[model samples]
Target: MSNSSLPEERELLRQIARGDESAYTLVFNHYSKQVFNAAMLYLKNTTPAREVVQEVFLKIWLKREAMSDVEDLTGYLFILTRNHIYDSFKKQATQLKAVDNFVQLQPDAIEDTDYRLQERQYDHLLNRAVSSLPPERKKVYIARKEGLSNEEISHKMNISIHTVKKQMQLAVQTVRSFVKQQLHI
Candidate 1:
């Protein structure tokens, strides 16, 4: 436990509570790397660790008014970091289970040849649809397909995270429509 009475960090918390941007910047500069390291230790991925850092700070900013009451700010921040990492694991597990269930729901009797043909057809249609997207949207779509997080895609593409999400949503809808049309589904 760091000395809670340390004037620098305590004063930073005060300024943050008062909505000081420089104070927020100072806190972020001081703690961002530590948070990222802790997140990486747990999440084991650069993108998700970066996301954890962003989310922790965002939460701090949103809850700044309550900072004065926190005795050990450093400890509080780490608690938030651990909680966020745990939430990420829970979300990932749920997604994996859903994927497992979907796989299990597939017809067991579908022969290899028929499955391979269907897969090839879907791949061809998906490739065609992806190639038709505008350059930036296509990049976002490809990054998402490669399992990059929205934050990672946004950083790589020099765009806002919201834009990454919107572009991905549009790309998915367009591809789904195109594939459905081809399959008469």
Candidate 2:
């Protein structure tokens, strides 16, 4: 695990620590495919796998100064990628649980008149919340609701993937806050 054991990677890390984009790019190009493949093996979806690659590299770049301290670059990247995927899974599970709770709170029979009325009211509130979003955020929110991936939204909107993610995050927060206010929840 000594620096001498990975002399080339050690040099790349040193360069990256000094804010060298070329060195960072070299490390990215060398490992991105492997990272994508590893992610695909677990995620079983191209979009999420691609997102993992982006997130892992972004973390690396952001923490470049610590790169030189990493004894094994490959091991460090693997840990980062694995941690991110686990986080994604946890977030998905939490969201699904929230939706499940919301559904469970409703009457069991959809044929109930009161249930139908409540459903409509909820839908109306949600629509209003969405409509109140900024134009770009609304677009991102709608695209996601339509089952488009972030990459697809980025390409369709001609924005960077990071921007698309940011917009979607902001849109969700805004809509959630608006709905909570409207529902007094």
Candidate 3:
């Protein structure tokens, strides 16, 4: 923990809370790599780790008001970093394209807020459906989606590969079923 980094980080967070772009840029350059590396330690994927880093900074800029109560800026960022990476895992498991450009890259025109609202609603339903899965299934789903290899997941969870695969399959099926039943689509 650099003493310079701590005060600099705290200042950046304060400026960011006021919607200052230069502060965000300065801070992003300073800490993005650390955030990426930390996330990569947990996520172990280049693309998702990068994406999570981008998201964490964006969220920090957007929600910097929470910083006043925070003691350690770096610690707060690490927690946010982990949460976003896990959310990327959930996004991968529940849908697809856990990247920034994917939405803009949608094949058809989604230039409507109402349509976007429905998409968000569907995403909510999907999350609820996932939450409703059995605990083992949810764990497997999160692990796999976070880019953990099946063998890694199996070893970490102390389960057999066969069991991991079965639980994942069951989780997928259950999520799909819940979506269909609840949303009729």
Cα lDDT computed for each candidate against the true fold: 0.87, 0.88, 0.81
Model 3 spans > 4 angstroms off = 1-6, 94-185
Candidate 2 stretches greater than 4 Å from native: 1-7, 108-185
Query: Distance from true position, residue 151, model 3, in Å?
Result: 70
- Candidate 1: C-alpha RMSD after superposition: 26.9
Q: lDDT: which candidate is best?
A: 2
Model 1 earns a TM-score of: 0.54
- In what order do the candidates fall by TM-score, top score first? 2, 1, 3
Specify the highest-TM-score model's number: 2
- Candidate 3 weakest lDDT stretch, 10 residues: 1-10
Over 85-120, each residue of candidate 1 has an lDDT whose tens digit, in order, gives 898789999999999988876655456668899899
Q: Worst lDDT window (10 residues) for model 1?
A: 1-10
How does each model score on TM-score?
Answer: 0.54, 0.55, 0.45
For each of the candidates, the C-alpha root-mean-square deviation to the true structure, in angstroms, is 26.9, 28.2, 27.2
Residue range 45-122, candidate 3, lDDT tens digits: 899889888888888777777755666766777888888877767877766544545776664555566689998999
Superposition error at 99 for model 3 (Å): 20
The local lDDT score (0 to 100) that residue 62 gets in candidate 3 is 72
With a 3 Å backbone cut-off (N, CA, C), the pairs that clash in candidate 3 are none
Q: Is candidate 1 or candidate 2 better by TM-score?
A: 2
